[model samples]
Target chain A: MTNRWIVLMVLLPLLTGVLSTPIVARLRLSRVLGVVGLSATLIAGLLLLNNATSEQAGGILVSQMGGWAAPYGISLVFDTFSGLMLCAAAAVTLCGYVAALGTLDRTVERRYFHPLMHFMLAGVNLSFLTGDLFNLFVAFEIMLMASYGLLCLAGGEAQLRQAYKYVLLNLLASALFVIAAGLVYGMFGTLNLADLMRIVRETSEQGEALPTGFTAVSVVLLTVFGLKAAIFPLWFWLPDAYPTMPVPLLAVFGGVLTKVGVYVIARTFPPIFAAGEAAEVIVPILLTAAALTMVLGAIMAVAYRRLRAVLCMFVIVGVGFALAGVAVGGETGLAGAAFYMTQSMIVAALSFLVCGQIENRVGSDDIDDAGQFSWYRAAPWLAVVGFVLAMTLVGLPPLSGFYGKLWVVQAAFTGPDETPGHSVWWLGLAGLVAGTITLLAALRWWTGVFWLGREDQTEEPPATQPASTGPRSLTLAVALLLAASLWMGVAAEPVLALAKDAGTNLADPQRYITAVLQPETTEPSYASTHGTTTPANDQAHRASPSTPEHHAQDSTPPATHADDRFGPNHPIRLRGGH
Target chain B: MTAVLAICVAVTFAVSVYLLLGRELKAVAMGVFLISHAANLSILAMSGSPILPTPDPELGITKRPPISDYDFDGALRHGDIAAPLDVMVDPLPQALILTAIVIGFAVMGFVLTLLVATSRKVQTLDVDELATGEKRHDPVERPAADGTVQGGAA
Candidate 1:
């Protein structure tokens, strides 16, 4: 029953968005719907988390759509990692929505804002929960589409241009995604992730080589995900586009979209491609990319004068951490990556919210132009909250941020095939240095905005007048996020435990595959050879000269090969072999 | 087939670079579209050629075609007619290209709208001119006032 509501937790927001579109003209009702739907989703997410914790030993709890099992129907798995992401997404969207509600003009509110926000939340939720690769693509589109709407909601010239680029880049990514999905489907004859895992393993064991087809698919998938995740070469468009959205929308986008891409990459890598030498090559490249991303993002953050732009840079930093963590590719690395992602999301969102507050008070986000508002005197509580969140972002001790970094550093140093000597050590050191630079950058920005005293009188008054009183609701929303960040930082044990469990699940993907595949009363014959002999042989075969011919032969529909691969009463073997 | 994709990719890459360097916003957008198409084509090429139909042995064709008679895959396979398209074009890249095309269209549309809005609001399409940074406070501010304000020294 609780699991049932978990699915609804995501669906409710989307449903409300769709249902309320007709009545969007009624601003009050749209507001009501947005709050109610998101609030309910938040509660549902919390409830799901509690249920998951209580039943931690129960393994992964799966809710299959339409009551069909794996390979036949779509499955939504609720594990510790996904559950945590779901809760974080729900919390961020809820807080961002509440914050924007108080300050968003009624006209803007009525014009698709509420619906889009809800849809964005729904998309984020779906991205976290879906067990199908194609479904992940769909979730991405849902989120991107909503983001497009949200990005250009203000209809400013600059925003429109930026939004265009954002939309275009993402659309290209989606297209690549579909093609990748089709390729994967063609190779394995299955779109279900669990089924793919089984098939990949079996093919390798059957002494069948990996087809060039799979390699092409893997590269394309990586490129698409890289574009979305904002890896160094592909990240130029993000800083430009993200800062243009309204602060609240920016906060959510900053926190969620790219992380969704990271999650996909993380989820898919160890399970499907762990055995491939390609993963080995890819990891080093990813590490290099991570280093570039970190240095570039930090430098850009320092260069930017706009508060929102600086926060956007931090988003890149977070992505870099996730990339580095993933590139390390072990239990500890994955845990650290997961922990870092969660912490980064919280901190990034808080920073954006604070930036929004400053923007409201100063009537500008430009650091040089923004005069200190005596916010400590004017909005003391908000200032305190903002300061705490900033400290968390800087990874000061006792905060969630510090723990996340610690986990990643520990993973980097202690992981099983630890890279010897200075290379991994340097990478780890670079990460630490990046973290320190980010901290200093945040501190510098904070000092300028909060503690520098008002700018000299010679500076021109900002073109727009500041709002007399910061919106009460907005303040409360920031306070809520601040409190949550601090609380997560202070009482880090439980969440860290959950993160650890999530990381473990991610690292050891057999449980994930089993949870989804659900070896029932009728055991699958192919299941036995999946992780063992077949996958390795298949990988070798793929690398060998006869791959093209073998792939052509293997591409034959499963219906034709199933009987030969596994006799009757041996469904698992058949499933695994094909 | 590879040659065709290669040419397309090269041409598109050049055009994209040229357009990206251009000052006109429209050219930039069009450049992006072209580059994306080029990328799509490149992906298709990378997937290799599709499996060609097996030649009819009865049609006066030998069991093993001569070196000159076969396509790339056949040439590689040493005229083995039995090899079902060993290099059948990977459908994944094609699928990916298709997705890229659709996304390109959506992005293009959004960008077009933005271009039009920017031109109207800023009253100047030149990015350099717009960089003067005269803040336009209201959505409904008159175009003339904006022009005068930025055009004037103060």
Candidate 2:
């Protein structure tokens, strides 16, 4: 039953993508299909979450396409972390889809917008669930291709320019990803992530060192993923590109894209890259990056005149939180980061929706222009909801964002004692300062846009104009997100528990390794009938001769190299062979 | 062989930088293309030279000879043929570069279309001119009351 739902989650969106062309003539039907498809995904996610905590030993549930085994066939794995991410992604996409249904122009809607949106959601789901590296690449491509269509759905000059830059940057990242995957495959002769993890662990243990070529490849991969996550120096393009989209589209993009990159980095770093002495070196570097990203993002937010642009800056703050957690490099840090990310996604979506409402009411997103209008008088609900979300962004106590940050701070303080001299502590201090600065920045914007009256008096429009009515659908969407944010903050314990489970699962590789390595002896009906084995089974059979101990030994020299490059106590190990 | 690839990459990089810094839109587009090619070449170089001997047929193991074994004549011959066959040149990078190139072309085309459309509608390609007239107005504002009689005084 679980497998059936998993398959449905992937297939529904793909089916929508395929049927979109023929259905393009019928915009209403397409919209209905999109909503139904996403609704199904949301249902599947809920079911998966229930299954996750049902004492069923919720390791990754591997589903082979044609019963073909690893090193050859493709497979999808639904682990707890991925399941939770998918649930969030599905919920967010569903809301965005519904919100967009009322706002999209009929002409644009008929041009396959709904289907493309569903397909993109599908790609995101697949990317999260897949256990193979190459499959992850394919999922990204699918998502990117769909994004291209959505970005240009309105086809204006600004949209074209922004989308072009967005596509170009992502293309580079994707290229780098493929190059990295290729190098890994050429070296390891397999693309199954689980298989690669085992091989990497074993190879590092054996004194047979990974070639410098592969290490270079790893750096390239990290760079690409880093760009996607919009960490520090790589974040310049995002603020410009994201705000150019229509509100609902921006909401979904804000909720999902960067987080997917963060997910990949978080999932792979511990087991594959930071496995050895390098863990000591790599953690600090990540910590510094996180601190810089948070600080810079807040500073930029204070400078932005547009509400959407400011929210885009906050997306960088979310990235900082995720990186901070990874930099902290322990269970507490990971759980905090995961919980923070979940909270950010909800808050970001709500913020974007509120921005859309403001834009709708005031006829602009510019702080100066929006200030002329009385939003509180024009749309009281929007003003109230926006204020709540703004507080969430600033990490107010009793909000999910605050708890998330608290956890991260706690994790940082309690980090490994061996690396006492590491600068993670300094980075943590910077983050705390940055967090306070961000709160001030948010408050400043709120005051400017809502509280303070415009100095330059302009004739106010008649109150009877009704402030654009702000599509009932969009209001509903914003309310949904606002409620979720409140719920996440108030009912935080269960979600934190889930995040803790996910963090523990990530730290302990034994269950994941075993599930992927050992096939059921019963020779399941699907395997025999399809005339192929599961990818995991093939991986287990074609195991490398080297053991984990050998790889651990081989990782020593590079670990020293990394330690030398980044001080001995640096949290992050740059060149350590993991 | 790696040296030759490296030089090619360096030249591409230089040309890209030169074009990118130029004022014209076309030059920037061309620069993007050049930089993409340079990146692709760099990836190829990082894969190492194909001139190195192929693996022993039985064991599928390639052997690296002493530096003295590589003289100019051997280098030229290896650089010529081995560049293509002896080494794989990292097929992954090649595939990635190809995708990047295609995406670059698509973006360039879209930008060109935007430029053309904007120029036709606004009568100028200058950024200052474009920014000054950013507001969306009705199409009816295009002509005067007499249709052809505009404010132009020749």
User: lDDT tens digits, residues A185-277, model 1?
Assistant: 544545788766665655555655554556667778888888988988899778777776777777888988888878888888666754454
Q: Could you tell me which 10 consecutive residues in candidate 1 chain B have the lowest summed lDDT?
A: B145-154
Candidate 2 TM-score, true structure as reference: 0.79
TM-score of chain A, model number 1: 0.87
Considering every candidate listed, which one attains the maximal lDDT? 1
TM-score for candidate 1, residues paired by index? 0.77
Q: Would you estimate the TM-scores of all the predictions? A: 0.77, 0.79
Across residues A390-451, which tens digit of lDDT does each residue of candidate 2 receive?
A: 78998889887887788777777767333556335766687788788888878877877777
Residue range with the least summed lDDT across 10 consecutive positions in model 2 chain A: A569-578
The TM-score leader among the candidates is: 2
